[model samples]
Target chain A: DQQVKQNSPSLSVQEGRISILNCDYTNSMFDYFLWYKKYPAEGPTFLISISSIKDKNEDGRFTVFLNKSAKHLSLHIVPSQPGDSAVYFCAASNRANAGKSTFGDGTTLTVKP
Target chain B: DVKVTQSSRYLVKRTGEKVFLECVQDMDHENMFWYRQDPGLGLRLIYFSYDVKMKEKGDIPEGYSVSREKKERFSLILESASTNQTSMYLCASSSLGRVWGETQYFGPGTRLLVL
Candidate 1:
């Protein structure tokens, strides 16, 4: 069973516009969530993360919002740039399963300049 | 910064051949994992090691085995190369902490093709 799911396979946006990526999970035990960005032929790099206790986390131009009641989380990029184009993966893990994370299928984001 | 390194960036092997993919971490992490990425399937864990000489099977460990000989190195072994086993393999390591979920550092990944 796929615990974490990214329903959208791909997304296209114009530069300077807002880009939003969504993810949902079925496992309620998951207390921590993470986001990773990957480029072609490269491994995924950590983007931002949120705890179950928090509703939002922001870093620079990126923001992550978590709604525990809905079991959904989203990543938002303000003023999206072409360089931000990449595949984004959403992962969930809890303290009991530290180090082992359940990852979504990933959503490919393309930003047009 | 944590650094994870894999032995190969790409590999090709014929059916029935034995293969080994090596990984090393510089941060002395206690937890290490091996995962395979496939199209539309996301990343599936093959094995995980929490300490030297210790390992646990992951979601898809049917054709794979793992070795953790030291604190810094974790290896993935393919007993018999098969076409279905070809995929991008990733290695990651994370330190233990009081926090709920520690961030994992990943290697560049090794793409293996079996014929």
Candidate 2:
């Protein structure tokens, strides 16, 4: 059973526009959510994260919104650039789990230049 | 910068052959993990070790085994390689900071193709 799920396999957006990637989870025990961006032939890097206590977290052009009631979270990149085109994976974990995160299938975002 | 290095970027093996994938981390991290990334299946944890001579099975640990004789190195071994085992393998490490849920730093990945 996949605890974390990304319904959309891919997304396309124009440069300078906003790119939104959505993710859902079935486990309510997860209190921490993180996003990772991966490029071809490279490893994934941390993007943004949000805690269950907060509804939103923002850093630069990246913003992550979490809704505990819905067990859903979304990553938003405003003014998306070509460099933002990559696979985004959503992961969830709880403090007691020793950082063993349950990752989603990942969404491939394409930013049109 | 933390650096996680895998033995090979790519490898090919035949059925029934034994395969070993090695990973080394420069940062003195206490936590090391082995994950497999398939097309539709994001990243699945195969094994993880929190310290030298310690190990734990992740979600999918079948058909594979791991060793961490040293704190800096972790190895994933396939006793009898199968075609179904062909996939991208990733290694990650994180320091058990003052907190336990530290972020993980990943390697470039090793793409293994089992024939």
Q: Write the per-residue lDDT of candidate 1 for residues A1-113, one digit (tens) a residue.
A: 89999999999999999999999999999999999999988888999999999999999999999999999999999989999999999999988975688899999999999
The C-alpha stretches of model 1 lying farther than 4 A from their native spots are: none
Interface RMSD of each: 1.0, 1.7
Worst 10 residues of 2 chain A by lDDT: A93-102
Q: In candidate 2, residue A35 scores what lDDT?
A: 95
lDDT of each residue in B1-115, candidate 1, tens digit only: 8899999999999999999999999998999999999989888889999899999999999988888889999999999989999999999998887486877789999999999
* Docking band of candidate 2: medium
lDDT of each: 0.93, 0.92
Give each prediction's root-mean-square deviation over alpha carbons: 0.8, 1.1
Task: Count clashing residue pairs per candidate.
Answer: 0, 0
Candidate 1's displacement at residue B31, Å, is 0.8
Residue-level lDDT tens digits of model 2 in A1-113 = 88999999999999999999999999999988999999988888888888888999999999999999999999999989999999999999877776678889999999999
- Name the weakest run of 10 consecutive residues (lDDT summed) in model 1 chain B: B95-104
- Model 2's alpha-carbon lDDT is 0.92
lDDT of 1: 0.93
